[model samples]
Structures are given as C-alpha cells and as structure tokens.
Target: MAYTSLYRRYRPDTFRDVIGQEHIVRTLVNQIKSGNIGHAYLFTGTRGTGKTSVAKIFSRAVNCLHPVDGSPCGKCEVCLELALSGNFDILEIDAASNNSVDQIRELTDKINFPPTIGRYKVYIVDEVHMLSKSAHNALLKTLEEPPEHAIFILATTEVHAIPATILSRCLRFDFRLVPTSAIAARIRFIFDEIGVEYEEQAVNMIAAAGQGSVRDALSIADMCVSFCAGNVTYDGVMEVLGTSDPVKLVGFVGNILSGNVDEALKTVAEMCDSGKSMAILASDVAALLRNAIYVKTCETAAEILSLPEEQCAALRALGEKHSVQKMLSVLKTMTATEGEFRYSTQHRILFESAVISAATEAPAAGTTAKERELEQKIAQLERKVQALAKPGFKSAPAKEDAVQVWARVASELQKKGAAFIALAATEAEVESDGGVFRVKVGSSSCMKILTDKSNRDLLNEAFSSVCGQKLVIEEVKKLDEDKSLPYITSMFGKYLEIK
Candidate 1:
C-alpha cells in the first residue's frame, strides 16, 4: 500500500466521526434521516474543519442501502461498491483546477443522468468559489434545478467569492475551526491507537500551533511522529513549528516589561541560535502580550483566551503587577514592528527596537510601583487635558478658555532659550489651577523638550508675563489627534538618528 497522509487516513467516514461542527452535522444528518435531502448543498468554512469530510459522508449516507441513524452503514452493497470503485457515481471535481466554462458545461450535461448503483448521484465540487463568472452562470441553472438523482455539494473556504445567486440555491453549512482541547483529544486518540508515547503538553502545543485547524494539527502531529520517532515532547514540537517555547515568550515579555534589555536580547539570541525564526518568535511574544492585556483587564480572561490552565494562571499572576495601559503600550509596539519583521531581513534589529519601544514606554524598573501610581495619576490628568483641547471645552470660572490659555502659553514659549521648545509645541495648550499651570504639549516629543524644569519655569514666567499672574508649572502631555501619521514618521526618523 502507498503512504497516506494522516489527514486522509483519519478522514471522517461517518457523521459521528466529524468534530467541532455539531450544528452542521446535526442538520445534515437529520435531513438525510428524514429524507428531506436538498439537491444543492453549500459547505463553507476554513480548511480542515470537516466541510469536505462531511460532504463525503453525506454523499455516502444519502446513497447507502441502509443508513443507521443518518450515517452510512459500510457493509451495504451500494456502500461497498462505491467505496471499492472510486468515482463510480460520486464525481469529485476540483473546481480550482477545472473552473472553466467548458468544464462546467460538461458537468451540467451529465447531471441529468441517473446514478449507476446508488440511489443518488453526488457531485462534490471542492473550492467552488474559484469558478469564473461564465462558469458560475453555466452551473447556476443546473445547481438551482438539478435532476432528482443528482446532488451537488459545493465546498469553498472563501464563500463570499461565490455569487449571491449560487449561494441562494443551496443549503449553506458553515464549519468552525475545531477547538484546541478537541483537537488534542483527537491527537491523543490517534497516538493511543498507533501505540505511540507522547506527553500531554506536546499534544497541546501541536493543537495550539494549528490555530484551530484539525487537518493542520494532524499534519503537524504526523510530522512530529516522524521527527520524534515515537516519543513526542513539547520542545520537539516547538522546534518543528519554528517557534520558541511559550515559556520563553513569557520570559521575554517579563524581561521587556521589567526593562531588562540585556536579558531580553539574550533570549532573542538564544532563539536565533537555536535556529528559530524571529518572525514566529515575535508572533508568539505578541500573542502572550495580548493575553496579558486580556488577563489584566478582563474579569473573564480564561473564558476569552484559549490558553492552558497553568499558562493562563501564570499570565494573570504576572499581569496583576501591570496596568492595562502599559500592556496596550507594549501591544502597540509589537503591532508596529509586525509588518516590518515580515519584509525586513534585519529581524534581530527590528526585534530589539520593538522591545526598546515597549520597555521605554513602561515605568522604570527600580521604582515600578511608585512610578506606576504616578503614571496613572498623569494618565488621568492627561485625559482632562485632552478634553480641554477639544472644541467647545468648558472649565471652572478660574480656568481661562483653553484656546486663549494656549495662545498665551505658546507666545511665552517662543522666547530666546525656549525657541526650540516653542517650535515643537506650536499647538500647545494650557489649563490654570489657581496658581499652577498645566501645559499639554503637541506630542510626547514636545513634552521631552519643554518638560525640563528650566524650560517650563521660563514658560511659567512668560505665562505670568502674558496673563499677568504668578503661576507654577505643573504637568505636560501630548495632544490627542486622530490623524497623526506625519508625527509618527518624524518621530521614527528622529529615533533612527539618535540610536
């Protein structure tokens, strides 16, 4: 016998064998049992979620001499013959390859004929969305009104590509990706039946790496089976996936947040030395950061994030020390570098830069607790400052109109020594507090320059000079702008020059 891939070997021969698509299976099985089979059926889903497998099973069941509870009984004459002689009456067409009008015309010409052995002639069209407009038009009429003996099962990963008219003619079944636990259970079943030794974490790793695709998981499991030569472990599977251990991801995140740049870079080097793809490692780190954000902010983190128990617990424990704001800051850094990592071959440099951005945004590691408290205080104040920048902003009687306040402060900033600061804070705004002045600069870069006590004091004297009142300098923050790409570009260029 020739070698068969795990996906094909483990293909669901019956409705009960298919996993994670209970809704679709139940409806189809019920339809078959009640003899309410439709002429045209559309199965839509991501790959490896049992759309094609269910289609095959349904084709067999509807033609079985005696189906048991809407499932095909393999021992029957019709089932035996159809199983032995492939494509007897079951014409499996790859629409991706044969998606031309002539092929569709050929298909339509034969649909009127009756099955040779089974009760129904089934035509399974895989990737039916690949059909051209003319081809779709040719098949539309036949699909909408196929002969009693003919049944069309159209399967496509991209269902939106199919026309609305074709969609309307068929009973559509959407298949969801199988959950990790279910995929792991199936892997365990496969390993047990094959008499292979494997660790539970190894199975989970494979399933998680599959991203909810059972076929993809099984394919990975098959590779692991060959690579490990029977005994499979998490590390072994991680190597195969070109991903660093999730533990490393957790450690890398901890190091980044704690501002331990040397330790974080060491971890990246270790992964690279071990022949791991920085792209995959970056992706893994990003996922853990996102999970950390969810764990820190959401009360139902476990419900929302599909992670192992111990991992989720560890994340939550680590997350308690961090703020939701900080996590989002790091997440933004990760997202910023994600596309760059894909295109640039300087993976190490990009990874380091992203880590630096994430770290620099965080409070200093020495006095983290106190700094976080102060940062949160500033964050709250910044929100008020933002509101003040908006049009029609109102404040207490002592507080001047925000626009007038900004105009006075900006003019004060443009003096001799603070000229550079004034240029950057062109659109700076101010808020009054009896004697304290809160100046919200145009952006963080501006804050970096103008927040120097000397510069701010100079501005304070000028604010007093302009507004004719003694005022103390207090706070600073970036102005909020929904359109700020030019600022990002300018700031990024400055960072490149500085670094």
Candidate 2:
C-alpha cells in the first residue's frame, strides 16, 4: 500500500474524532439531530483547525441514510457514495481556482438538481473568500435561496473578505485554534494506532511546534516518526524540528542575561557553524525569554511553559536570576531583529550587533521598549541625547480607551489645523502614556500648529467628551518630511489666511 500522510490517513471522519473543538461539534451535532439545518452554512477559522473536515462530515450527515449521533454511518449507501471522489451528489469546489463569476454561474446551474444518490446536493466551497466580486454577486441569490434539495457549505480561513450580504444569509460557525493538550492527545492516539514507540517528552515537543494546528501537529509528528525509525526520542524530535537544544538555548540566554558579550557572539558563531538557522536561533531565544517571564509570574509555570519537565524546570531555576525588564529588553531585540536576520546576507553581523546593542542599552523609564531600542541605537551612532519628561510628563490615565479618545481630540482639532497636525503626526511617535496624549510631529511646521497656544483648549474639550477628563498634550519634534497632504495643506492655508 502507498503511504498516506499522517494528517490525511487519520483525518477525522466523525464529530467524535475531532479534537479541541467540542463547542463547535456539539452545536453542529445538535443542529443536525434536530433537523433544523439551514440551507447555507459558513465555516471560518485558521488553517488546520478541521473546518474542511467538519464540512465534509456535515455534508455526509445531511445526506446519510443513517446518521449516528449526528455523524454519518460510513456503511450507508449514501455515505459510502459520498466518500468516493466522483460522487455526483457531493461537489467539493476549490473557490481559489474557480473564483470567477462564470464558474459560480456554472455551479449555480447545477443547483436545481436533487442528489442523484441522496436527498440533497451538497456543495462544499473551500476558500470561499477567493471568489471575485461578481462571483459573490452570482452566489448571493443562490446561497440565500438554494432549492430544497441543495445545501451549500462555504469554508474560509478569512471570513472578513466575504461580503456582509453573504454573511447575513448563512449560519456562521467560527473555529478556534486547537489547543496544545488536544493536539498532544491526538498525536498520542495516532502513534499508538501505528504501534510506534514514542516518549511523552517527544510528543509534547511536536504538539508545541504545531502551535495549535492539529494538521500542523500531525505533519511534524509524521516527520518525527520517519526520522526516529520506530523509536521517537526527545532529541530526535528537536533535531528534526530545528528547535534548539535545551542546553544550548539555556546557555545562549544565560550569556546574554549575564552581559557576557564575548561569550554570546561565540555561541552564535558556533551555532551558525553547526548549520542552525539564524532565524530559528533568534526565535528560540525569544521563546525562551517568554517562557522565563511566565515562570516568574504565573503560579502554574509548568502548565504554561509547554516544554518538557527538565527544560521547564531549568527555566524556573533560571527565572529567579533575571528581572522582567531585562528579559523584555532581550526579547525586544530578538523579535525586532528576527526578520532582519532572516533576510540579511550578513546574518552574523546583524545578530551580533542587535544582541550587543540590546545588552548594553538601558531604555528610559517611560519610553516604549521597541521605540526606545531604536532611539538608543541611533543615539549611539550620532551621540544625541535622550529627552526626559518636559517638566510634566502626565501620570497614567484610566487605560485602553486612550486611542479612541485621542482620535476624537484630533477630530475636534480640525478648526485650528490641529487635525492636519494630528494626521501628519501619524508616522511620528504619537502615543498615550498615562492619560497624556504625547503627539510627536515629524515636521517643525506641524509641530508649531499642534503646540500653538490657541489649539490647546480645542484639544482639551475633545478629550473631555471622550474621557470625562481634561487631559494633557505633550509635543515633541523629530526628523520627518512634509506629511501634510496637498489638499489638507491647501485647505489649511486658505483657512489660516482668512483668520
């Protein structure tokens, strides 16, 4: 027999077989059993969460002669026929390939035909979002009012691209990413059925790598199975997955934490010589820092870390040696430079420089970590100064609604050209720290308009309406070009000249 990939071979054929999606399965099964199934259904979620599989199973259930607990009985004539690829009753369309209006019209032409082998003609359109605008228009009427004998199941990873008209006509089911525990359980089940010897540690590694995709987990597990030669071990899994060795990861983080610049670069060189990817190395360090943060804060560190017992324990031990601020600095660097290292021909220089910069620099007390890091590097190159609070750095505000409030303030600032200033300041470091709106302008001209004493009260009134408080506005100037649009500039110029 030819080898079928693990994900395909162990694909869930029934609701009972689906992992980590109990909520969706229960609702769907209930609907199927109650015979309250709608004519059109929308299944949306991230890839590998079983949207497509559930669509297939649901198609079978609707047409099956005998459904067991809302799932198709594979033995029934209708179910058996639908299981085959050439079944006329069930049509699986890849909307990605056939996304034009003509294709949609052709499929709609078949809508009047009742199932040749079953009571209903089931159309499963995968990646339904790929349908063009005209194709969507063609689908709207049919989807909203398909014949009694026709059932449409549209699946999409991105439901947002789908028009609201189409959304309103169908029953929408959003799928969540399969959790790690569910993935691990499924992997264990697959390995047992295959009679493959595997360690618990090895299984967890694959599950974590899947990052909440059952399909992804199975693919990694399949690779591990072939690589392990019947006996899967933790080291074998890590090697195949390109995850750094636990010991090396610990050493790399430890060197960075201790500010041993020499040792850190040496470790990077060694890893590179060993053929490990720079991107993976950076990612590993970032993940390690994240797990360390969890270890320090969360009471259930082991439950949260997702690493093997030994590695998790090691992180816990190391957590006591680091502060959250220090870890954040390292994390900021690793994450910021991950993309750079991925594309840089001089990966070694970028990796070393980023780490060295992160280690040597101490971010200001209130600056954003990401922004502050860039500023720190620029400061080093040009020897400029980092500015402190201008006598009154406003204290912390209520919380998350600051952006919404600031937007209102900008709207109110329109009369005084503060609106143009606000729009122009978009590219600058405009942020709300505390209840204060810190508006940094790239152009000095924009800065003058925002900071003009006349516009202050207008901004204050806007803040009052949204926040129920008259907040402060802090202005700073930075290097940037003329950001004002030509139309806005003309309008503002005319208004100012009249005033």
lDDT of 2 by residue, 262-347 (tens): 88889988998999877677767877886776666565555533445677778877766765667768987886686465357887
**RMSDs, each prediction?**
19.2, 14.8
lDDT of 1: 0.69
Model 2 spans > 4 angstroms off: 99-108, 259-273, 294-320, 335-499
TM-score on alpha carbons, each prediction:
0.68, 0.66
- Pairs of residues at least 3 apart in sequence or in different chains that clash in candidate 2: 396-434, 397-434, 397-435
Output the worst ten-in-a-row residue range by lDDT, candidate 2.
Answer: 384-393
Clashing residue pairs in candidate 1 (N, C-alpha, C atoms within 3 angstroms): none
